[model samples]
Target chain A: MVSLQAAVESAAPVSRLHERASFDPADFPVPGGREEEWRFTPLRRLRRLHADGPLDAGKAGVEADAGPEITVVAAEHGDPRLGTAFVPADRVSARAFASFREATIVTIPGGVAAERPVVIRVRGEDAGQAAAGHVLVEAGANSSAVVVLEHAGSATYADNVEFLVGDGARLDVVSVQDWARDAVHLSHHHAVLGKDATFTHMAVTLGGDLVRLAPSVRYAGPGGNAELRGIYFADSGQHLEHRLFVDHARPDCRSRVTYKGALRGDGAHTVWIGDVVIRPEATGTDTYEANRNLVLTDGARADSVPNLEILTGEVVRAGHASASGRLEDEHLFYLTARGIPVEEARRLIIRGFFAELIGQIAADQVRAKVTAAIEAELDAMARAEGGAR
Target chain B: MSTLEIRGLHVSVAAQAGESREILRGVDLTVTAGQTHAIMGPNGSGKSTLAYSIAGHPKYRVTSGSVTLDGRDVLAMSVDERARAGLFLAMQYPVEVPGVTVSNFLRTAVTAVRGEAPKLREFVREMNGAMAALSIDPSFAQRNLNEGFSGGEKKRHEILQLQMLNPKIAILDETDSGLDIDALKVVSAGINAYRQSPDHGVLLITHYTRILRYVRPDFVHVFVGGRIVAEGGPELADELEASGYERFLAMEGAPA
Candidate 1:
């Protein structure tokens, strides 16, 4: 007997009342790399994803499984919540939204607390191929759950993810972009929070030739809170970018964003852009954002920009900070003065710089994996320098 | 018996990118083992520069000087090399090292100096004893190294390190600048305890003679315009406190 889930996923498109997102791929114009959002990105290296390139069906595959209380369904076009939070904000995301065949919807019933996290694994098995994907996550009122979107393997992929958090619910979404060395990834994630909801979104970007992720948030009612935290490391010839936006539309809402990155080796680059908008009606809103980057080697580059737009002065607190610098001379001096060698001192400082954020990962295995990845990046740079010498 | 001998020492510091200014001029001093020397001077007289130059601080450049520790060229050593070569400097403004606990820093320093990691039990026992002797609270072991420590606490921590590392020569740069009487007595006791070693030497650089009353240097040198203008015994320190640097400043036609 064929499984019920497989039949549903392969069935004809589901009928709904909402208008379908244009799948023409030509609906979005090609970005010229001169736009403010695209200025720091290298458009010529995108492998033609910006110019209506075909998304190979077998390039990247998705396999999602979840706890017993959550229902997983294959949603077709015209599903209202499919594109509700996740509107294609850019050309690549628009192309991804337009070309995807079916979207996956994962729903958690009201007040049902899952004992384990919902794990969605997306693995790329082919090189020089591009694929598009979409996932919609909904948590009903008073429920609490964690959804982990784990990406690994090869292929150039573009995808859009959405989160609809219900009132009084708590939801944590961790999206890890751990692609292969030759792969390229561009993803957009949007979360719409309900009244009195608590939402947390974390992005851990470690691998990929060029990975650009944009995660945004919007609140439906007051008393909502959202936190966006991310960590990334770019090695030689790697480009990693994370751009986040938090829109405070409801009064008494709160939001926070913190992203830290380290770069080493020649042509290793990272970009973090945090934009927070507090509307005039968003009185009593409290928001803060901070971005810090540590450039380990000589040729690495990091660009951090934190923008805050407050339409009214009635907010509780709003502030933003961005800092990028190499290893501090004083810190090195302090360490070396005690007899630790220069290389060991640097390793210790970098470890300490990332310890705060790494400790925040609730998952033990992921935290260990991230720490190991950082160590590996450092060791790779050391090996490269040794080889050059 | 070893000695740290400095003769005709001259040093310059870069005021900016291109310009250099001389801070130490024609100073001569000898610190033999089992002796303590106090170099007292007014602000901006280059007392701290001498301490840093001997410690090989990158900010201070020795233009024409010879610093020899037991016939080894101290001037040719890097900061860490100088530290490993049995020379230590207790800075006035100890840098704050975040995310490094005091216990870890001390253990690492000791390991580096001894060229091997110490046994955990022995290291912990020694650390506890040193902390107790310096009157450091037990919680300080877990705190980040000098990150948020008070002035007195920093001085005590420095002495704690001096005791733990046990360098052949120790230079206390303005160690008594920001301390209460009780703290001064405690720190002085720690230094005196280290001075009990027959092969250890102490160099105290201070603006006030207040700490000298507790540590009691064997020799006192009055510094003016980056050089020692007057050298005498402990009586010189008493005279400087009683009469101030007016007589010495006027001896060189310098402003007091």
Candidate 2:
């Protein structure tokens, strides 16, 4: 019989387990949809960004805004600071790394706290051509900053984002993928935290035809803390997937992952996978991960999986939970019985389901924008589903 | 003054294998303005069913009966419509709506009932007054509605809504089931304070007469086997408390 340790080890893909990180596109092979990581993704809709497809020469529309305490520069791909945080793990990221002409590097000086966030907006111009881009946000020692990356418009895009947080630093990153319905995007977010550093990353995926985001974290030293939070809404014919990996290679580190999603309409689907591993030598690690999905209408599907693997017995805590379900009947009754109309009650519950997570967002504008987008989505869902009532 | 009249109310709940079982079998009662009606019964005596059926819970279907609030066909109204028409039920077990704060829910409820959103200052003052009367911490208003609340906290929150909504008719379904003596006294005082107005009516359903000792009922009903077997004044409550529900269950042949 295979041992429990072997079984647990086999649950996650070996490719991701000993992740091959390189900036060379030749180091990765094109997936055939049979690989565990690509099994759930629809490859045909990716517009050949996965293989030898030519990447557009022109950069996607890009804009950056930051306070005086930070610097934003578009340097060539050979910039020494470009890939300091992480190497390209998959084919798309490697392709983006190699094909992109220039990469945006945002740097905050050590010990200087930024009053405002470093905001970067990437707007895709065409759905007919595939595009590639890259961004790196670097926080020096004892520095505190917030960085937001907003993606919009319609195009087939692949990119990578690196966050390097220094010792005793604080970094909050909010990446929003609110594209047109015809857009197809794949992204990789890599973060490295130093001693006593704190990092938080929020991914709000609202409008995309097929969006897959992979975010992974690695600690450079002990006393590092990372929180990865995400929210997504999938309408008809849309696919949204978020996969996270938290690698605890150091002692006395902590990680928490929480993601919530809602699906409505036929063929609307969402997938959330949280993988956490505590190395044998990494004792005193505290971690918890959870994913909750709300299926609002017929013909919608959600798949949630949480994989927690521990090689050492000495741990502060380690746990995971995942659930996908419809709204409770009694929840509706409770709301309506309080004089909220049926439609309004359903909306309120859906909003309430997301409020707690959204409230934790540090940036006020992103939070308000996400809330308004959710309200609009709810309005459209009501208009479509209200006929039955 | 409003009147809630239930004439020959029969309610059946959906059960296993597509079959519906009758819970309230021809329950007839009238709760008028300025009166407190106590519905005392055993665990399976269906008194709670009577309360929910009148409140338009979709789970309990009304069959061959009529429930009217001030001559309006309450059975025909939706759950929210009934609430908008000044009907409220303090459930034995309130639902826990995560992320929906007590303050937000109360404001939404008050807005829906009053046909307009109250000004921020006015609403905060009103909520503060009601919460203070219930002895709830000011921070309690910011907590999610009934989420992680204790039994006493949930009951007190129900009464807080009762005060804020200021409904014409209130149905207390086993509100005193899970309360300590001190909480019971506080809840009773809240009910008594709300009942000081002659225009409000109350239908208190419970299994014991412990709460009736504090909030005396104008009418006492002994509910058993889906129907009221006896009705009288406060003396009936004392009699039942002294003798327990044994005699009534024996009379109904409810497998005692």
Candidate 3:
């Protein structure tokens, strides 16, 4: 039983060994497979990583890239208090108690529109170790921007990211998580929207051994809104899960969550759990959540659950729906009857499934990049099953 | 050389399984190029079923029949293969494919049926020309295929596909069902435009005589109880339209 305070304090690394001491795997606490949240996850996947050793930070590479119409604010160790305020100390302490400590802080100034995307690139060098980072975004009143966070590795790694959005500002955040096949990824993103603010987040997950993404958003002010969209594909012994929580804590707030995933090959499992809550005082709140899963193979499995907990009696609208099924035979028949080959028809349907989320992406470059990545993933899966035509 | 030949065709729905309540009971018909053939039938007379079976719908089981396009056996091929063999069915109810633009769908369908990739600029130019001819707005190209479209719009979309695909044999399954007079004229004009090549054959299925008045059929067949009972010149459509299907029903009962 580790305390949250101890975890935060432990994240404060000694100056001399900043590079080596920053991401040491030995300092984190193990889950021991008993926690309820970790029940469905395979802890052995984490055990295979190096449990007690410093990360090879010297091997880390920095490749800075610019994105479309996004403003990037890079502040390393800008202010520890900023991180403390954005990320609750208790959650920081938990990661710290688990011996994972590394941070990246980003800020967008008020009323500033960056025409190019701000890309935050994080890389890990070790195959069997853990790493964590933090991002804090502040958009001033009447400002808009987009942030592209890319997580990649030349080797296997486990990582986490925390994000925050500020008041009266709109933020479009795109996350591309493509790790090595042997890697395990655990990402935690927490966002808080302020008065009259709007936030749109889209995540594309294409590669990983066992990937779990928990994105939680809270509407803390009136007229605040959040739109969350994600696309995940798993194939050949891959396990991908996305758990989302959207809380409407104030009146006149709205939120929407949509996630779609495709699975192929045996032993592949895709899971989605969307939980939305409208508190008692959060009157005039509107929330809608939907999750759709496509199982491409007979042995593949998809489990989707959309849960809504509404406490307010004056809410305008609140509902959640989930669907898990194979491709529709009628759609396939219609396409094939038009002279499209069966394999091409399947590809088109899969592409169309993800196109819904991709179409909602406001930025053209981001949408194109995500679509290309998804197609590549599908091609790889098709090749693995020897079903590519 | 374009001709659709059906011999001893027996088709049934999948739900009935081996019980086999035949929709096209041993029906034989020949439709050659350079001719318009109208199939007039009453409701539940299996007009659309015959059209679907010829186009290779998965639900329409061909118990013991053979459909040939030109010299190629159509029944032995897949739906897509039959389409590529130059057979087209203008579905009475076109399926809506959300998120797929009509232009993209038509382009893919045309290229697939032709077995070659078409030049993009040329395809667009030709598509625009067809749209204008069909009285369809240019914006319709950007919309999802047949989604949220009015009944007339759906029928126009089917005609647009017909003009673009340009199959050797086109089967129009009640293509004039839901159109107003203006839309019907526009659609008939588009179909007439497709008649430039005598190598193209048309199997027009309709319960009314209005479309036949516009696109004057060269031959007419009266279908009753899942079988064609009588065949005559274009005068037969006028006869059927004037006297209804009672004469055809009596002819069918004559047992010849």
Candidate 4:
């Protein structure tokens, strides 16, 4: 095992967070290339960030806005936990603290359903360094709220968010990871669900030099449910990866995940990994995971892996499926025969693929905003690839 | 004169490089404006191939033939271009587009066919009237194109598109399949409404004669072994429905 100090020394970019004292990349064990979980992932992307510059918080203008009733928690020296437990003092604490140095947290009181969305806007300043943040959402019992985390910046940055859902509570978290063209983004979101609690998380990754997001959910109580949906599109030289893990710890819990991605242009690689685990005590647990990828160009690549681990013999249902391929020519011909231009037809097909995920949004305003953002991203990508030729 | 004329039409299916199998077999048919022609046929009679070939499906190769819509060379254009040239095919299996709403698709199709943007109010009114005439729910306008739709709903949507686009020539392939009597009545009523246009021509293809009773056709052609072996008035459909395609198959010496 490599020590935090030694790992930081080995990875140059890890030195930038040294000042914050909470986020030490070296603390987290690097998965060997042989690990089953990291088998398909290109770990080289992380190694590249090793030599990057320290994140300049001043240059990376990350802003947070909350409703009047909501409380804003800032990352100050005294507030060490950042609203959630800073686990494994050397591991996530350093990263949480480094993020806390400028991170903002929003809290919705018990039984309060906020009409306005809590928006966290992150803008990067430099292209070399990375910036991360910790989002701690504690929805009290029977409470419901919506949070929108928007990532838009000119520089490269790494973002981390951890959420906790209370018993019988509901939380809707929508994340827009739209960064600069030359920036690299690595985001990890871990969620813990309580009894009868509901958690809905959606991610739209449209912009980044290289982007990777891992969203994991653990149902700790019986009858808990989690819905995870994601949409990503990558064009020319862009890499977008999403990995999801659903852990069912108790009986009668349900988990559903569906992710769709579209890749275009040369060297565009998009990956999806879905893992579901049903513990011994989690009998009668119902879980389904599916990932679908569409390759829109000759050189674009998509990799999908769906894995399920069932330890309970009494499990009711556990299934996983993965598919990756080029767009169906017959479907294209069908659309074109209706007089739709090829470009517009592609847009329709792509939009249709992500529509089911977007429709799951509970808030109309947030749904519309997300839809518009997706459209803008698609248009920009289409124009960029169109102009390249 | 409004007419879709196929003169010595020769079509083939591309099997491999420079390898094509003749399918249409030099078939000839004329559908003048203001007339509905029912092409009744058994399986593999090139009925669908002819329809798809006419609609410019790239898979269907027309080795030697001329398909002219109102004297315009349709075979020379692309599928969508032919649609803009006033041709429409109500697909037998309507493709389901999960995210596109019926109204958006209809608006786009109507705009493309008309070569102009349709005013929202007028388009909505027109669509609403059509849906009402077909006894369709107004909420259907916001649903995704044929996504999660019932069999009858899909057929109704096809006719809805036809009523909205109002093309010069419409080819409906197996539009009567999977439809109940009430739905069949609604679909026939929609087609009947479009038949009032003197410039409109319809070629309805079906395996059954149930729909012809509702929307009477001027001419009926029995397609067997990739050729139209028999032709007559509306009574021919009743005759075929009674005796089945056995007589036609016997006449052509082909297995039924």
Taken over the whole model, the C-alpha lDDT of each candidate is 0.85, 0.90, 0.75, 0.78
Under the 3 Å rule for N, CA and C atoms, how many clashes does model 3 have? 11
- Summarize candidate 3's per-residue lDDT along A224-286 as a digit string, tens digits: 989999989988788888878786778999999999989888888887878776666788988
Each model's backbone clash number: 0, 0, 11, 5
Error of 3 at A188 (Å): 0.8
What lDDT score is found at residue A179 in candidate 2? Answer: 96
Docking class of 2: medium
Q: Which ranking of candidates, highest TM-score first?
A: 2, 1, 4, 3
Model 4 lDDT tens row, B1-256? 5889998887889777988788887678999888999999998888999899999887888888799988889998887898888888988888788788888888877777788889999999999999888888999999988889999999998898888888888999999999999999999988988988888999999889999998899999999877788999998998998899988887564432
Top candidate (DockQ): 2
Error of 3 at A18 (Å): 34
lDDT of 4 by residue, A75-162 (tens): 6535654535323222323443454455566677877887787787777776665555556666777778888888777655555576
- Model 2 agreement with the true structure over B95-137: per-residue lDDT tens digits: 9998888998899989999999999999999899889889999
Off by over 4 Å in 3: A1-40, A48-93, A96-98, A154-160, A381-389, B16-21, B246-256
Cα displacement (angstroms), candidate 3, residue A260, comes to: 1.6
**Root-mean-square deviation per candidate:** 8.4, 2.5, 7.6, 6.8
Off by over 4 Å in 2: A1-18, A387-389, B253-256
